[model samples]
Target: MSRHDYFSQFLHAVWHGESGHPLVASLLAQPAFAVYRNTIFKGCVDALSANYPAVRRLVGEQWFQGAALAYARRHMPDDACLIAYGDGFPDFLDSVDAVRELPYLPGVARLDRYWSESHLAADDAPLDTAGLHAVLASGRDVQLAPQAATRWHWEPAYPGYSIWNANRDPGAGPLSGLEWHGEGALLTRPEGQVQWQPIGLGACRFLDACRAGMGVAAAAGLAQAAEPGLDVAVMLGELVQAGAFTSFH
Candidate 1:
């Protein structure tokens, strides 16, 4: 076999935990290779761990690591996997019927995955209306960019956020018995820090319009239409305060 092909196969097997054929002996003999494998494995676990701390906390570190390790070592990434991981975890969890009892587990994992992606997402300056003139000038045609920073979306089943947030901070809140009905939340980072909040159905529609590239005036109407009694001023303030809009001018 070609040397390049043989080496590539050997490395893939080492990282993926598949049978290495004859190259396993060479890989084990080299101290650097052993260290490299350990480092890569630990790094993967650490990244996965950060993305699913609540899952780890819920299932305990030992069991979580054991399961995570088994999965991480086995699965081949879909594409260029460096920028993102855990893409399959939600599906993986869903398939594990045994864990179906923890229905919220997959959802929580999904949120955690979202948080990680948002955190690592490309940084950008969120638009802001610091002056009254900019607000007036914006008139009604303004629209938020897809990259606009904003607080997290919140839904009825959002006790999971509280539960997840609690574990991140010290002695924050109760972790158990926080389950609720349906949940829909939005998390945006207007600044460097991430903020989360619950959104009403109408508000969701409004944001969806903006997210879909609708203009402010049009989005405003959409929100108001969704809920006739919607307080536009209040909703705007909440979105602004939560760091939703960017470049109001």
Candidate 2:
């Protein structure tokens, strides 16, 4: 094998402990090597910790660090930039048998990931009143901004949204009861900062339809279908003010 391949395999074995020592097994015995390995693990753990603060807060530092190290060992960093690391963490949480009792962990992690993604999304100008007016005059389909991100997760068994929100805001009071509700989160970069809003169920459908390239009327119809009493005009106005749409084509 090429030297590069050999080096890769050596480091892999070191990180995963899946095989015998690398070519320089004696070197691995050095205290410095141990420190290096630990540093790498710590870095990965730190990144995961930052990305999923809510998860860490929910699970406590010890449990979170353990899980983070295990996950890092199995799923090494694919990108040099750690900002987007742990993209698969929510799914990973679901697979962990230990966390099965806390089934809401995955959903909370998903929301945490959403926040990180939105925060790192490219800067863009949000659709404003004049843009909305132009779209209204054209009478065409609309699409979300490239930086806009929207997701919905609902579990009848758990209150994922409330858990996420409570943990996200430091001063929020502890949750009293586990009430289940469908939650919709929308993220957009407006004025160079990522802003997120918890939207209503009907509004979630509306955004979904709009993102799917539906015109205002059609999207509004979809929203109203989900919520019969929904006010399409008002909902559209609110979404526009929230900078949800980029342009109508």
Best by TM-score: 2
Q: What ranges in model 2 sit over 4 Å off?
A: 18-26, 29-31, 137-146, 149-157
Give model 2's TM-score versus the native structure.
0.86
User: For candidate 2, lDDT tens digit of each residue in 62-169?
Assistant: 999999999998888888788889999999999999998898899899988888887786555556678667766676555543335434444445667788888877
Cα displacement (angstroms), candidate 2, residue 192, comes to: 2.8
Each prediction's whole-model lDDT (CA):
0.67, 0.76
Residue range with the least summed lDDT across 10 consecutive positions in model 1: 146-155
What are the root-mean-square deviations of the candidates from the true structure over C-alphas? 4.1, 2.6
Q: Tens digit of lDDT per residue, candidate 1, span 1-249?
A: 688887777768666645455666566667787777877777677767877877888778987787677667866555445447777776677677666677667766766766766777767765555653366465636666545334344445545565556655465666667656554566777557665655676777788887788877888898899779999778877777676665543
Q: State every prediction's TM-score relative to the real structure.
A: 0.74, 0.86
> What is the number of backbone collisions in each predicted candidate, taken in the order shown?
18, 0
Give the runs in model 1 whose Cα sits over 4 Å from its true position: 19-39, 76-84, 130-139, 146-159, 175-179, 217-229
